[model samples]
Target: MLLKLDLTDSRPLHEQVAGAIRRAIAEGECAPGDRLPPARELSRALGVNANTVLRGLRALRDEGVLEFRRGRGVTVLAGADQRARLVDQAGALLAEATRLGYSRADLVELIRRLP
Candidate 1:
């Protein structure tokens, strides 16, 4: 999977990395049981610290989206279809919000207000 990170963005590198992986999984770029690149390799590719990549991987692991094994590397979990649906819905929401002149933060705030 290819991940793009914007250093100028306010979010931390770890969070951005995690988010990128999440989106990739959610968009069906990765299916369940697929193993991700080793943390050190991913870190090298992204030009970030290995620990940063590990932190992102661990965050996904904590969310049950990935499994870390001693020598098998990190594996994608099941429930990809559900995640894809969610990502599609989120995209639709964002598109509509933009059409309505709302920024991403505005859409998030509006969603937060929903009961």
Candidate 2:
């Protein structure tokens, strides 16, 4: 998997790691049932701590984009491509709303008001 972190990005390292993996999934770098490189391997490649990589992986798993299996490693989940895309879009929306001085609750309200 090709994971790229923007050194200029101000987000937390773990978030950057997660974003990179999310992008990889959205771009088809890996597919459902595909095993991911170990956290240590990813940390070495990204020059971050292994814990940071694991945290990122956990975040992806929480978002339903990846799955963790005992002795089987991490695998991309089915429909991950679409899930990743929605995550990207939601992140963009949140960023825009924050920039516009709207709180997350306000964003939620806006969505609720939508048809």
Worst 10 residues of 1 by lDDT: 80-89
- Tens-place lDDT per residue, model 1, 4-110, is 88999877899789878888898788899999988898999999999999998888788777888888989998885466457556767897899899999999999
| TM-score against truth, every candidate | 0.72, 0.98
Q: Estimate the overall C-alpha local distance difference test score of candidate 1.
A: 0.84
Stretches off by above 4 angstroms in model 2 are none
Off by over 4 Å in 1: 84-115
* Residue pairs that clash (backbone atoms under 3 angstroms), model 2: none
RMSD of 2: 0.6
* Residue 43 C-alpha lDDT in model 1: 95
Best by lDDT: 2
- The C-alpha lDDT values of all candidates are 0.84, 0.96
